[model samples]
Target: MALFRWGHSWDAFHDLEREVDRLLQSVNLSLSFQGLRFGRQYPPVNLYELPTEYLITAELPGVKSEELELTIANGVLSMTGRHISPEGAAEERFRRQERPRGVWQRSISLPDRVKSDNLSAEFVNGILKIHLPKADEVKPRQIPVAFGT
Candidate 1:
């Protein structure tokens, strides 16, 4: 009777393991499909905001600066560009491919009101830097406060 019980328990444990493996496989498939669809769209970016101004830096290696487009409209800053992988490379086998290719657009919100006309962008060393000057009225100022007796 003890041997019979042990055999039944082992079978139940194996069944549970199989179910877990199926669930994990389904999740991985879903993620792969989503990544494929996203890669066809825009690439990812990193945005940084400071006290006096907003700074935006995007990674665009292997792409010319002229190929990028930066635009500011209605307080939104947009960076769009395309990074094409090198052709004729025989090593196509990829262990992991998280970096996105193709065309990508990234939009960032300013920390404070900014003068769109005064904005400037520079691309150097595979990094796109954008400097947004804050509006005069929105800049931080020290105000004197009178002590009440």
Candidate 2:
């Protein structure tokens, strides 16, 4: 008379699947997953070593020049900035927000000492370029040898 009989094992498997789905939804892969949440690598940068200077370029989309701060100390170059949310963004709920927001910082260690006072920075088209002139002692120089003194 009975067509089929489902066992308790089927119910257990369904429960396990539901739990896995819930766990996945609760985790924000971009921020945290393991024991701790990792900091984001905002405004990824590239460093170029030249004969006389060092060039550092960073992509800072959605961030303004006024919101940025640059400093160098102890052979380290520090960059601090804030990315403000768009106007009226608070009114809507974001299902998935990935862009960096709020105050963030990044630092890069210089291979050699740089003239901080003479350094310059420029921001254009959402890209930041920094020019750090190498110190006198760090710059490679050629020595001339005299055949007869």
C-alpha RMSD between model 1 and the true structure: 13.0
Please list the residue runs of candidate 2 whose C-alpha ends up more than 4 Å from where it truly belongs after superposition: 1-40, 91-96, 143-149
Please give the TM-score that candidate 1 achieves against the real structure: 0.57
- lDDT (Cα, tens digit) per residue for candidate 2, span 1-149: 11122356578576665565456546644554332234436667878988889999998876777899999999898999998888776736776666667888889998889998889998889889999998998766799988996
lDDT of 1 by residue, 1-149 (tens): 01111245478676665565556555554334322332233443555667767776665656687788888888887777776766764446666555556777777776668889998888788777778877888876889999999
lDDT of 2: 0.76
| Global CA lDDT computed for model 1 | 0.65
Name the 10 consecutive residues with the lowest summed lDDT in model 2.
31-40
Cα TM-score of candidate 2: 0.67
Q: Give residue 34's lDDT in candidate 1 (0 to 100).
A: 26
- What lDDT is reached at residue 84 by model 2? 86
